[model samples]
Target: MKCSRCDRDAVIFIRYNGEHLCAEHFMEFLESRVKHELRKQVDLKPGDRIVVGTSGGKDSTTTVYLLKKIFSMRRDIEIIAVTIDEGIEGYRDRAIGVLSGYLKKIGVEHRIYRIKERFGKTIDEIAMMDKTLIPCTYCGVFRRSLLNSAARELDADYVATGLNLDDTAQSIIMNFARGDLDRLARLGPHSVVKEDLIPRIQPLRMIPEKEVLLYAILRGIEFYHGTCPYADLALRNQFRKAIDEWEARSPGTRHSIVSVYDELKPLLIERYRNFKLNRCEICGDPTPGRICKACELRLRLDKIQNL
Candidate 1:
């Protein structure tokens, strides 16, 4: 059937809060989200460098594509693509190939930093060593450190991530559930970059996951379609599945929950400042403990092999 919205032939069905959106309408939805977020959080000046961490997955790949297109239209910004190679056997390598091709096609400069070359351990090796901890948690910790360090090395003004609404919302729920006001207060469309902190910004903070997937498909963007093999065993996976089921029952349940959190953000901020921030003695990132979680995890892994 020809889509009423974009005249493209409709394939997959997206019932967005009782409104039927074909793939093309879905793409518009995602684009609108990106535009809204950009207008909200970003103010680009000429020659300002925006570094985007891409994994060639649906979210990050779509992020790069949109940012490149959007920034290319304006004369005020430079976009740089950086992909962290986590050394996941079949996944990261293939994703790197796809991302490189896309970047080359559009004449965007891209950098791929491999974990094996930078760190001594592959994600798989680390996972094998730390079987008790979820693999994603370890990967996330290492990836964040790598991304921040790389952004600093690149001398970029802002580090952009493909964290859409679903990811941010899930994190909000998790933090609230754990009473982690410090982290929750820091969550928003724009986070101010501190001298000691490499600021990470999410331009698609309001876009839904379903919309992002549709955007990737409609734009013919190449992405890692397979789920992270280690994701099934993670607690976040359980939370994601639970939210997915809820979304099926109520089309925008996740968004609604996040909206409520946003409404209560001021109170969250008050609670956050009530607690004093401390520096990690090891890495010096803001942490309540003497050593940050990432450093602690790395030291733990190191000791395990030594034992």
Candidate 2:
């Protein structure tokens, strides 16, 4: 099929929109939406620093790449790529190498933090220590903690993530299904800035996962394609599978999920607007509870080691 916008052959047919786009139009289609999303998420000023939680995957690589491209002329805006090393041995180790090289090649400053460094054990070790909790249970808490700490340490104005439409939709449905209304309200791209917790920005929040992968390939962005060794055990897997099935059965299902959530999120946030955040007594991160979830998990790990 010919390109929807030009004579070139269509590289991919977008089922959600029913458009056949070539390499040029596909990249443009992706970038333009990201630019719109980014603009809606933040109002950048001179010297405003943005830290991206890059995982060396297609989504993250595209996020960093596009952010750099969009703001290339804005010399005053500083963009840094931060990678979390969850210490999954060959998996995370190899990703950081690819991430580092990519960041270097793109002229973006890069940094890496490890879960083992501050938490006293790698994710791999923690998984072995506790067989009851899923690897993602530990990983999710540790990664969020480390990423926030990394942002605070760097004094960033905003923390960027690579969450795409699929991830966004799954999270919304999962939280709604579990009756986690507050968490549902708190999903990013975040607009509010909380102390010690850098608000997250997701440029790819509206983009689909497959589109991101194709864009990365077409743009020649180097990214690690390895799956996590413990991925099969994630609680999110069930949600992801369900959402994927829905999307396959109904084109634009993901978009409909996010769009409806977006419409409802304002009311959700307003309902919880007055709920206060308390500092984690141990780590001082912001949380609605007395102790942050990360510290709570860490305390559990400590008790396990003592036992």
Candidate 3:
């Protein structure tokens, strides 16, 4: 099909927006939308540092590359990449290598932190401990804690992540389904939970996952294509598959769902903003309860290992 904007053959047809775009226009659309979303979240100033959470996947690879491109001439704004090595042997090791090489090539200062070092156990070792516990339960809790701690240690102004539309939509659905109003309220382009926590900005949150992958390829960004070995064991995989099927049938179902959630987010935040937050007694991270989820999980794991 011909590109609606030009004479070139179309590379993608955005059914929601009803536009057929060639490679050039597609790139332009993606970058412009990301920039708009980014600006809506936070305004970067001189001497501001953004710590990007890169996993060497398509979404993160695209996020880092675009951030550098957008602020290429801004000498005051420093972009650093941090890769959390979960030490999953065949999975995380390969991705870390790709992430390291990419960061070096782009001249971005990068850091790698291991879960084993921080939590005293790698994901592989934790997975061996208990058959009843899902791996993601450990991963999600540990990763968030590590990222927040890393951001604080780097003294960054903001933490940036590559959470795309599909991920957001699934999260919204999952939260609502599970009656998790507090977490649902926290969903947005930018995070504003606590003072000690660095605010996280999601520039690519409005972009679709497929488009992110396309953008990475078109921009010649290097990334690891392998999926996490334990990914299929999570409940998220079921939601992901269902959401993909819905999008395939309804064209813009994912976008529509997320857009509605975005509209409702303001009201949700206003309602939940006054909810009390306390520091985890163990790790001193902000938590709704006395202890944070990460510490709770760690205690459980430690107990299981002792037995």
Candidate 4:
């Protein structure tokens, strides 16, 4: 197909906006949206440090690369990459290698945190337990806790993630389905849950997953293309497929869902703003209750091991 904007052959056809773009225009569109999100959500200053949660996937690779490109001349702003090793044998090991190589190529500082070292067990070990929990239940709670703690330790102004439009839409649907209004309130481009927790920024929340992958390929950005073995067992996989089908049927369905959530998020936040927060007595992390989800899971795992 012919490019909608220029004479070059079109590489992608965005159904929602009805724009058929070539590689150059597509890259421009993706980057411009991300830049807009960053400016709108994150108030970055001259010397602000951003800790990027990179998993060597297409989304994360694109996030770090784009942030660097946008702030290339701003020497005062520092970007560091942090990868969590959940100890998922073949998957995480290969991803770490890709992450290391990419960061080194771009000359960005990076760090890796292993679950076993910090939590006394790897994801594989936790999965083997005779518990009634899904792998993602444990993995999600622990990984998020580790990232938040790492961000605080690094003294970063913001912890940036690679969550795209699909991810955000799925999360909104999931939270609403489960009647998790608190979680739903926290589902915007930036988080403001607690003072101790470094706020998170999602610059790619406006972009789709397919566009992120295409952007990485067109830019020659290298990433681990493998899927996690345990991903099929998560509820998110189901949501992802359903959302993809909806997007296929109605080109802008995903964007509409996220847009609605974005519009309601501020009101939800204000309504829940005065909700009390406390520190987890065990880990000292902020939690709605006396104990955090990570601590609760850790205690459960420890009990199972003892049994």
What lDDT would each prediction earn against the true structure?
Answer: 0.77, 0.91, 0.89, 0.89
Best by lDDT: 2
Residue 98 local lDDT, model 2: 89
The C-alpha stretches of model 1 lying farther than 4 A from their native spots are: 1-14, 22-25, 274-277
- Each candidate structure's count of clashing pairs: 0, 0, 0, 0
TM-score of each: 0.89, 0.98, 0.97, 0.98
Model 4 regions lying over 4 Å from their true place: 191-193
Give candidate 1's whole-model lDDT.
0.77
Ranked by TM-score, top first:
2, 4, 3, 1
Candidate numbers sorted by lDDT from highest down: 2, 4, 3, 1
User: Better model by lDDT, 1 or 4?
Assistant: 4
As a TM-score, model 1 comes out at 0.89
Give the clash count for model 2: 0
Q: Every model's Cα RMSD, please?
A: 2.4, 0.9, 1.2, 1.1
Predicted candidate 4 versus true structure: per-residue lDDT over 12-123, tens digit per residue: 9998999999999999998889889888887778889999999999999889999999999999999999998999999999998988998999989999988788888999
Q: How do the residues 96-122 of candidate 3 rate in per-residue lDDT, one tens digit apiece?
A: 888889888988888988899999999
lDDT score, residue 299, model 1? 86
